[model samples]
Target: MSDTLIEAGKRTIELEAQAVKALGERIDGEFAKACEMILNCQHRVIVTGMGKSGHIGGKIAATLASTGTPAFFVHPGEASHGDLGMITQDDVVIAISNSGSSAEVITLLPLLKRMGNPLISMTGQNQSPLAKAAHAHLDISIEQEACPLNLAPTCSTTATLAMGDALAVALLEARGFTAKDFAFSHPGGALGRKLLLKVEDIMHSGNELPRVEKTALISEALMEMTAKGFGMTTVMDGQELLGVFTDGDLRRSLDQGIDFNTATMIDVMTAKPLTISQNRLAAEALGLMDAKKITALVVEDDQQQPVGLLHMHDLLKAGLV
Candidate 1:
């Protein structure tokens, strides 16, 4: 029984893979035309479909929206029931139906046309009403379904999904969509934290920043480090950043038989330490920390003065690690 199931799964994968490959090869000037229409659209893209195509359409709309193109899924059935009002003249419509003859989706054609909206259609038959009516047609036709009985919508759906991804990616590149732009659209997730979070957003500043004067005793620097809980402290001179002292520096001083009580911060501090700009991405600061084998960095301003401190724990708490 297990052997039979495995064979069925493999067969389905092979057939669907072939269908998707064919779909990729079929991408041509028409695909470019569809991309151009969406790119030039001044407003949102309205994706509509029925049944299985509806599920794929919703995902496609989300992908487009998150990738810099504004889009939303509108059910074809709902659209005919006054939901058609959701679409406007400025919006572009993408109606999806594998057979190109879903009554619910087809019913919206005249209404969309009357609204003067540019219609893009995804269908199996180029001569189908929906295809002929579209300003640009995306052919998602498949040679056969992966279904053993050849009745299910497996291969066709896969092709439609791939085509949607292709359209979104093409528009993304044309619009010069960046990771930061994607992050703004997905600001609540871990990906957003990594891409949108900056050093200044979470860095320790003002009273939270650990600082000690260069002439202060090493024990005083240690006190500041302990108070800040960063295991490090910045050593400053009169109105100037002098250096930094870390737990590692304390360890080395102890090994050299230097008393923290007698040794001054200027004697034990590391001079010319690495500093980071506050506006830099947190992920970049993490990279620098990893490369330097350090746990923290002093945030500096353009005028070359220490303004804050950033610790690795802040990144961990922010879900950036």
Candidate 2:
């Protein structure tokens, strides 16, 4: 019984893979025209479908909306019951139906036509009424279903989803949609944090910064490190950043029999410590720390003065990691 299930799952995956692969060869002038229509749309792209097609349409609309195009999904069944008002003359409609004849989806065609909204149809059958009526028809037809009975909507839906992704990515490139633009739409997500959270936003500044004078004893530097709990402290000369004395430097000092009470921070400090710009992304600061195997970096200004200090914990707490 287990063997049967495994073989059936493998066969299903193979069929779905073939269906998606076939979409590459099927991309032609119709696909280009569909892309052009959506691009030229003055307002939103309204996506609608029934059943499984509806579920796929929702995801497609979300992808389009998040990738520079403004789009939303509407249930085809609800269109006749006042939801049709959600669509406007300036919008373009994308209707999805495996057979291109879902009654609920097809019934809205006349009204959409009257509203002068452009129609883009995705269907498994080329000769279907929905396809015939569309300004541009996308053929999501698959040779067979992944279901053993060849009656389910498996391979066809997979093909439709791949086509939707292809459309979205092509449009993304055409519009020069950038990562920064995507981050604006998803500010609550990790990608947004990585892109928008800067070192200045998370770095410890002003009184929270751990620092000491170049003339301060190692004991004083250690006292500052303990007070701030950063396992490190910056050595400053006036407003200029001189060096850094970390726990690692302390250990080396102890190993060399140096006296913390008498030795100055300049005697034990690492000259020209790694520093990051305040305007840099916190994620980049995290990368620099990881690459250098350090726990913190001094945030520096244009004059090489220490403005702030960033710790690994800051990036983690900010969700940039």
RMSD of each: 1.8, 2.1
Query: Which window of ten consecutive residues has the lowest lDDT sum in model 2?
Result: 300-309
- What lDDT is obtained when candidate 1 is compared to the true structure? 0.91
Query: Which stretches in model 1 have alpha-carbon errors above 4 Å?
Result: 188-191
lDDT of 2 by residue, 1-321 (tens): 999999999999999999999999879999999999999998999999999999999999999999999999999889889999899999999999999999999899999989999999999999999999999999999999998798878999899999999999999999999999999899889999999989999899999899899999988887899999999999999888889999899899989999766889889999999999999999899999999999999998777678999999998899877
Assess candidate 2 and give its TM-score to the true structure: 0.91
Clashing pairs in 2: none
Q: Which residue pairs in model 1 clash with each other? A: none
Query: Top TM-score: which candidate number?
Result: 1
Our tally of clashes for model 2 stands at 0
For model 2, the stretches where C-alpha displacement exceeds 4 angstroms are 188-191
Backbone clashes, each candidate: 0, 0
lDDT of each: 0.91, 0.93
